[model samples]
Target chain A: MIAVAQPTTAWYLILAALLFSIGTVGVMVRRNPLVMFMCIELMLNAVNLSFVALARDLGDIKGQTTVFFVMVVAAAEVVVGLGIIVAILRRRPNATADDMAELKG
Target chain B: MELFVFVLASAMILGGAVGVIVRNHPVHSALSLVLTLFGVAVMFVSLEAHFLAAVQVIVYAGAIVVLFLFVIMLLGVDQSENLMVEPIPVQRPLALIVGVGLAGVLVTAIVQARSAVQTGTGAGLDNATQTGDHDSNVRQIARSLFSDYVFAFELVSVLLVVAVVGTVLLSRRPARLPDDIGATR
Candidate 1:
């Protein structure tokens, strides 16, 4: 069992997969939009981990480069998404995603 | 040295993640998530990805989790009062089966890949003999970012700016609350 410690890069990828899936479940189970957003970030982070691991394995900088792009998009997502949530909350104090099911006022 | 660090960090990170999911209170979960993020950062460091480790702590634990806690407080969500008393639905069984199946697949994939790596597997491993100007993993990363895929870098920066503006618009509310729907005129 001690031999299990030295994981190949594939282990990291699998770990990333697990993390992303957990985030997906979090999004499904958690009712709060804020929590959902956090879960989404968790999913994005898992991908970053995958990119770094694979890049190292391939002996190339390409994966990390892709990760950088993903990071940028993630940053933007948080800024915009959280801002929108706050705005919605401001308008309707308890603005949950579950509550906003209607198409029209 | 490597073996010790990996084992300890992985155990801690995995445990923290479990704690976060098991805890019912949002505050407890958030705090456990912090531990998870920190543990993940340590794992990143072990993987020779220092930059990512830093980002993991600052972005995930420092900023993101803090923002989450703030929201929880602001919303004043009372799980005790607001908790759904519905019976154990189909979701519980489904979630369990899916989660366990994914874990099994992952463990199998990992075991397979470990047996497949060729010699001198990772670039991050430091060799004292290769002492030249280009000696660090960070330097290698910088070289790649500037040399190739530079266009993607610039696009991401633009995305950040757009996100900032969009967030403002999305969160903003009218200065005054109009009680009547027709009062906006």
Candidate 2:
């Protein structure tokens, strides 16, 4: 009977949860570093979505501000991560994550 | 209308996320990520965080995704990956199990804590109390950012500079030592 009800905060939270889970799976299963990095971005965006939803539900601006900070941090993270990835891939083109075990010794 | 937008955006987000993982090519995954980021931006608009919506588009979709594509092209690693060559036999199944468990736990927690999200006594997030002043969302965010969060804002700027310098050092080729050059000459 709830045909056209607006999405509640809980709906957004659940969606975020699902997205985070997918990202986690991608990071775990994918061997390519670039794909794993994208998965991390997915997880970050999921967290941002939940933060915005809760901010609206609680009538708080702090949550949005926190999301902004999170975005900034994520950008920095991506920059550093991709730089490392580019360096590694440059040394051995098309190297998988498993091949980066040279430092294990 | 709201429900439609929510459902459509959720579909975009989930589909793009799945595509990112399932696609064989890194370029495909990167494009899928763009889809997911845009969907998140749409969700931001639906949540009435208009300024964040704009930023989500600009910073995430515009800047970040383009950077990702640039890396892919620059590296020339756009070849399709082999998804079937699993060195660890149980890794994929184990990851799936872990992901499912995480989603289950989070959904349960959200459902249990649903009643805790009562409307607070914070300032209202309305738009345009007077004519032609329709930027209340951005205005309030700016006030908060410049006031209580100014110190953190400055720290983030510092972090960005460090990241930039570190990336330059990390990605660039190391300079040849003078002795090595003399020996080669």
Candidate 3:
């Protein structure tokens, strides 16, 4: 009988780092506000994965409980973010992030 | 079994992430994000964070992605953008370079220090068995949340209410056009 080594905590952390980098690239390269928003969601999920992994490693329930708070915050952020996107699109149809230069001084 | 599940979930997560970035249409990107979210939920379950896995599916895949689709439909910006067109020159290349660099640094750090970090402490699973109570993960989480972290929990509720109000105020459309302002008077 052969014993297979299980995946380690470091593997989870590495996966999270990879996911975070992907989200960062998406946010930078994608022009659409909605897509950028989705990328942000991806980034948040990656962070949540890290939290859960650490919680499991450390035997702490706090980390898992914190995931709940993070989820709530993420939901709120999506609502407000999408509302802003909708408002912008309502006034200017098919507006990309580049077109919103009104904030540039 | 665990190693196989981890590999499968990680592949799904990374594939979905790439899909979200590479897809030209917003709807496709949103669907890809759902895949990524589900993969994360699966990872949570494998980590023994069952409560978080459930919440990830319910709140993220269920509610948050629905909100994303709602806005995508309402805005009607489903048309695919030109991938070849670069509104900002050098943005894509720069992002790729930076992303690859970041991933390299992280992976290198983990590889170098892998042995120092302990694995399989089993504290999470131990909490349930050591006491002989056979309490579920959710119950343990509830005990910590309601007792030790009660104040922060209440604050999150308040933040949610504020977010709801802000979204309503921000998305409200004008009842009448500006040109109608003078005609009625």
In order, the TM-score of chain B in each prediction is: 0.79, 0.90, 0.87
Give a tens-digit lDDT track for model 3, residues B24-94. 98889889989999999999989988778888899998999888888888778888988888877888889
DockQ of each: 0.40, 0.62, 0.64
Local accuracy of candidate 2 as per-residue lDDT tens digits, B1-185: 88999999999999999999999999999889999999999999999898999999999999888889999999999999988788899999999999999999999999998887667556656554543578888888999999999999999999999999999978877567433222112
Would you list the clashing residue pairs of candidate 3?
A: none
Looking at model 3 chain A, which ten-residue stretch has the lowest summed lDDT? A96-105
Error of 2 at B175 (Å): 2.0
Error of 1 at B176 (Å): 4.2
Those runs of model 3 whose alpha carbons end farther than 4 Å from true positions after fitting are B118-135, B178-185
True contacts kept of 2: 0.80
lDDT of 1 by residue, B1-185 (tens): 66677667666666666655555676777787787677677767767676667777887787778877876777675252133542337765677677777767866776777767663444443322455443465566677777776676676777777777666655555557756432212
Q: Estimate each model's TM-score.
A: 0.80, 0.93, 0.92
Backbone collisions counted per model:
1, 0, 0
Query: Just chain B of model 1: what TM-score?
Result: 0.79
What class would a CAPRI assessor give candidate 3's docking?
medium
For this target, which candidate reaches the highest lDDT against the unseen true structure?
2
